[model samples]
Target chain A: MKKLINSADTILEESLDGFAAAHADILLLGAERKFVRRRTLKPGKVALISGGGSGHEPLHAGFVGLGMLDAACPGQVFTSPTPDQMIEAAEAVDTGAGVLFIVKNYEGDVMNFTMAAEMAGREVASVVTNDDVAVEKSTYTTGRRGVAGTLIVEKMVGAAAETGLPLAALTALGEEVNRRTRSMGVALLPCTVPAAGRPNFALADNEMEMGVGIHGEPGRRRVPLASADAIAAELLDAILKDLAPGKGSEVLLLVNGFGATPLIELYLMVNAAKRILDSAGVAVVRFLTGSYVTSLDMAGVSITVSVLDSKSTKLWDAPVQTAALRWGV
Target chain B: MKKLINSADTILEESLDGFAAAHADILLLGAERKFVRRRTLKPGKVALISGGGSGHEPLHAGFVGLGMLDAACPGQVFTSPTPDQMIEAAEAVDTGAGVLFIVKNYEGDVMNFTMAAEMAGREVASVVTNDDVAVEKSTYTTGRRGVAGTLIVEKMVGAAAETGLPLAALTALGEEVNRRTRSMGVALLPCTVPAAGRPNFALADNEMEMGVGIHGEPGRRRVPLASADAIAAELLDAILKDLAPGKGSEVLLLVNGFGATPLIELYLMVNAAKRILDSAGVAVVRFLTGSYVTSLDMAGVSITVSVLDSKSTKLWDAPVQTAALRWGV
Candidate 1:
């Protein structure tokens, strides 16, 4: 792969080094360098930690700061971080309030975080998010895979944690956010892993993969490339069918890019998505358009909808001061 | 040609609609839908206005908000906006403190903005940024093309404007900021202009275009793809040659992606860029890494270095709450 990396073996450490150097004021790299925690910890506030593979940047690390994640333990590209890494991050960020692990519903991530919590032996609680409506079983997981909706869970849980929510309440809040969120993605170009040196999957010039996973895992199926409006309709139909929100339900829409997609295309897709939602009598009160969760270099986009009520809307609108998502204080 | 756009002819208007819909709280679309302004104007504050071609998003329009541009005029894709659009934006944002136009040094942009400034009967000043160190003349300009450094200019000028700097003082500050910055870019894949229905240029599988412009303009001739460190060194070497900063110069570095590039690669380039700057006896006080000024879906990056002093550094660190770039606000 023609990536701007020194070596595949050093990609994780070097990238972490870059992150540490660029945002030293907001993130502190642990001695092991596999984990990152807030530069300063706030006492009596519940600490939020989330992480997974490394390729999906700004996912865990970029979300670490005030009003969001307190710590993040990033694994190698597409690999799970070891239990030791997670434990270190947990120990570093945990104050008197407690620690919450926001885990995506992936086999490796769930297993590793569970081990880390057990090894730490602290008042740790976890919430697993499985919001992808694409497939029941994917290449790496038995059930549905976690996707962009993980960002919503983190935002809501982080805001609630800021309010000094106890461990059980915080966990329940995260679970509720997950239950209210659904996501679906399509890929126009496959991403190349630095180590693999080739695209993970292959498609013809005029073919596109619908409901594709973040890791290039198999999705519903390949389909002929279609116009933006048609593609938006299909993705939105799948997501709305899975969500089944009531008429005139308020929701937060996220048009997330999978790495190689441009903002122009993302914005266009957002336009199409808004049209679809408008026709369905859904009121998208809040929205974000960017590459929050991304595959390494895949040219694609994912649509995420978080059905929100009064309480959930308040939490989602709460202040967040992370590298990726920031608003209000 | 596989883009998430309904059609080439409608892409610009539809994307602007998406931007307005997604960020209604921060932006207000004008009657003609050719420009964007802040939702609420700050009376007596010097207003900053910028305009250019439409493809480089989050540049002019996304930067319109508190502590940034008061308004932005967007032209057709890769084509400069007409004088009427700029005049409307200028008139709308021109408070008693007057308006400052930040123009990129492209032929059409400079000409149209100059005409608009002349048409504007009130106090108006303009600063044309020409910071590209790649070429003296390119496909669209007679001199160095404006690149990502324009963002730095807007940011510094915007902060100064918040202090109620007069139109003359704001113009001088912008010009000084432009004078101290230099940038160079590279492209791995050419972007497909919506109207063109194809990529503007071509590259071989193992080849890369160094110093490519934001409009797919040719740069210092292409060479075989090399190591990331080597490429970083070469780009930095060219930029430093153009800047000629003395030893111990404190600079703000920006590793900007040309759309369609992954954050992983951008971060890695930042890592590489830092090493080169550090070794060159330069101290990087601050930096930003992401897609700032992009060319549709071109897969590449541009590195910008602005030699900073105490005054400029203070302005650079000021709060900005735009959609694309925001911190400390």
Candidate 2:
């Protein structure tokens, strides 16, 4: 296994210490490896908490700040934070208004955060996002597990909560966004898990996995690699087929690059996506092209589109300050 | 060449289309693939513009918004954006206040953005970040060119600019931040650029390249693949040897995963990094762990430490909002 690290055993703790130092603006909780906002709570404002494994940069951690998630708990890489940790995070940040947990739809993430939510009880409301269109209904797993939809859910629910929406409203909005949003992705090559120091799976140099999940999971279908234009066509066809953004309906476009996919490729893909959408007559009002949430280093890309209304668009435009996923009107 | 993308030609445009649809709140010029905040520029605020090749997911584009760059132009994967594209970005986003160009240490990025800055003329004040410690002083290239230091300089100088700091003040603050920061990274495997949909370079499964820059450039040294613990030790030792985050000094630690590293490994590696710092008695105040900036599916990690002071600590604490980075009080 090839890596550039001092000692895997002590990596997390030391990294957290440095995290605290780099971000003195936030209160660092070493035990949980969390970066909490310095301001404990805003009177009458609901607290927002989000978490996931560590490898996906700036997802849970980056989204902690004003107009976004209040606190983000970090777990071991690719492993969900323990139930107790989430409960602790809930208790630590919850105000009178309540707390909202935005969880991606992974079995581990779902189970852990659900347990945490149950422990949180009336203290917070947890919303699970299962917006990945890559997966169809399955007997073993829940239908359409969440991939990048977590970002949409986070932005939407976070804004609603910031607007002083109660737990019920926030939950409703989160669900609505999930319902209206859809995401799908593919991988050029399997990522190498550092601890293991090996590729999760061996993919041929010319093969690409379609509908890949974030955790190095196999996609629904695997096929020979194609050009960027063809990949955009496939992904856009899937997304449009799933959501079908039509005339008079506004759409929020998110072109997310998995780790290792360059911005130029992402940019080029977005351009191809536009041609696809324009030809389809989809009215795209807002666009975001970058890696918002990502799997470790998988050479792939995911496209997420949310059918937007004025309210959701307004919330999307609201100023947000967090470690990741921040933009505002 | 292994990639998930269907075709190469249309990747950027298609990706942009998908991004805009998903983030309808943020307006993007569909023709140009530029990302601007949904909100109009406040009067009297100078526009801060930065951009580079497309592979650096959120670097130039994702950092567009309040308390950060006003606009970021997207370039082709691993290649700089055209000067015309940048000029358009500058013109569209400028709000009477001259724009500021933040260029990274790459020769292509520097050269291209430099041309754009000149084309932009007096309308923009450009500052370059040349702070990487790995690339030593040499007549062959700009000495120790910028790596992650571009981010710190942008955040600090950006915040100051938002607070209406003079251009000179912003430049001075940027230089100071660059002075205090040092970064060292390694690459486990070479990335396959979308255009060249195959590995740029080869690495034996047991080998690791140290002192690597973000692009798939040559590293200072290539050595046998070591355990994460040992790799962390070598990286931190090199970074620490150069940075010397001493016992009494406050330092912000960064355990950045190159693509393909799992968080569990990052966690373990971060813990390893902490012990090293603790043994040194560095007054660690902050730490950031994740894939903040990355090379395409490069299975490695980088350790960065910025010696901090009250001013920097406070500013670092100040809220920042971007897709890849966000934090503030």
Candidate 3:
């Protein structure tokens, strides 16, 4: 694999430096060599901190702005952020209002964030996002694995924090968002991490994997790579069956582009999803058709749906301001 | 190639529906199925909007939160968003404050966004981001084509808009940010769009493109893929030599992972960037690492640096909130 780096050891630090330099508006404190936080700390607003492996961009850090997370600690290529890094992030962004930790349900992420929350001397609340419909939801050693649902939890809970909602409220809101959401993903080809300089998993030229995780973990099932429509149906079927939206049920649909799936395919999948939902009598009241959370360049797509209700829908419509996400209508 | 799709024609609408389902907080409206905008509009906040091909996730949509863009219209995979979509985005996101169309300086994106801005009823502020240091700045076209630098401009300028900065001021700030920034990229293997479901460009067991674009556009130069250190040196040397940060100058660095590059590799590149800057005596005040803007599963990365002054640095510290970017210290 062709890469541009002086040395493997320096990629993370240098990348952080460059990212921080680009957005000085957001403070990129490298105190722990892996933590990033907003420069400004709210005096009384409960700080919301989230972190995990580093491959997903615009995720934990891209979201460090108003109405979102206050700090993010990034781990190595696909590893969870360490407990110490999370602890520092919590301390740096925490104010009198306390702090809230939003963690995806990966075992390592959960353990690390939990450790950080426990270590923090200040008040803290946390909610794990385990909305992935692809998982058995009960079979994983770590419980339902958190997938792209983290984005919704972060945005909604981040809004609560921005509004000075208590940490308790934010925690509840995070869980609420998770309850309303479910996601499932599939991969066409394994991605090659630059550091590894090789494919994460080898598939024949014509194979695909279903239920792929963000780190290129072995998915639940693998089959011959199929056509776009076939892939879309497979993904949507997994998602819809898991969600089981009733007729006329409003759903917030997200046809997420995995790291490498093009928008064209995403849109095509969206079309397929609509037909499936329409035939099923589900109405999509909302949509977010882009990459929110990504697996590093894995050629696949995921379908996420949040069965909407009044409170959740209202929260979704609430005014929010952040570096990467904003909405108030 | 394997993919799932009934047809390409209906992909966008279906995708939009899914997108809306995921982000019910953000309003979605468009009859022709081309554009979607934030639910909240700040009248006269100089609505910032951007769009282009769809494979680069979060470029236009993920940036729809506060400190960034007011809206983002998506195009088909690897194809520029249609001009009609751009026009609708302009009309939908436009407040009395007028609109600023931020184009990434691609031939197609520039043409489409420009026409849409001109066709719209309201006067609009349009700016092109062309900070790819690898693409030689040229009067021959515009300057260097925009890449991840567009993300920086979106964040900083979006913050300026949140402050209710006037259109002229917003334009000026965006321009300043654009002027101070530079970027360069490289790719190991070409990525395949889901619709195509195959590599866009051919690569042997050992080959790389030195300055590829998000859509796998041929880069300025094609060379034998080098070591991460050598590649980083080559990419940064061009940027440093081109940008030429003077003595005592400070920079905001952004080492970006194009779709497939992992954080482990990003850190190594960051080290080289620091060494290059350190040797040149350029101060690194802030940094960001991870995939901010990505191509569809391309195995590559980019580096961006914004030479900063005190005012710009302070703006970086400003307390602003958006969905994807935020800070308040």
DockQ of each: 0.70, 0.32, 0.29
Candidate 2 global TM-score? 0.77
Q: Give per-residue lDDT, candidate 1, residue A301.
A: 94
Query: How does candidate 1 fare on TM-score?
Result: 0.98
Residue A158 deviation, candidate 1, in Å?
0.7
Tens-digit lDDT track of model 3 for B1-329: 54445454555556566455445464454566576677778776788888887767646675676566777888887678877887777777777888888988877788888778778878787889888876654322365778898888887887778888888888888888998898988888777675665788887767788777776777777777687667777777888887888988988888787766655456557766777777778887777665668876677888898888887776665554443444441
Looking at model 1 chain A, report the run of 10 residues with the lowest lDDT sum. A1-10
Q: Tell me the spans in candidate 2 whose CA falls farther than 4 Å from its real position.
A: A1-39, A42-128, A137-140, A192-198, A244-246, A288-293, A327-329, B4-54, B61-128, B137-142, B158-177, B193-197, B227-233, B236-247, B250-297, B307-329
lDDT (Cα, 0-100) at B91 in candidate 2: 78
Residues A1-329, model 2: lDDT tens digits:
44445555555555555444444554455354544443445667787888887767657765676677877777776778788877777777777788888887767778888887877775767788887777765322466677787887787787777778888888888889888898888888667666776788778867888888877777678888777768778877887788866766778778887766655466566766776777777766777766667776667888888899999989887877554544442
Score residue B100 of candidate 2 by CA lDDT: 75
- Candidate with the greatest TM-score versus the true structure: 1
- Pairs with backbone N, CA or C atoms under 3 Å apart (clashes), candidate 1: none
Q: What share of the true interface contacts does each candidate keep?
A: 0.56, 0.45, 0.48
Interface RMSDs of all predictions?
1.2, 5.0, 5.4
lDDT of each: 0.90, 0.70, 0.73
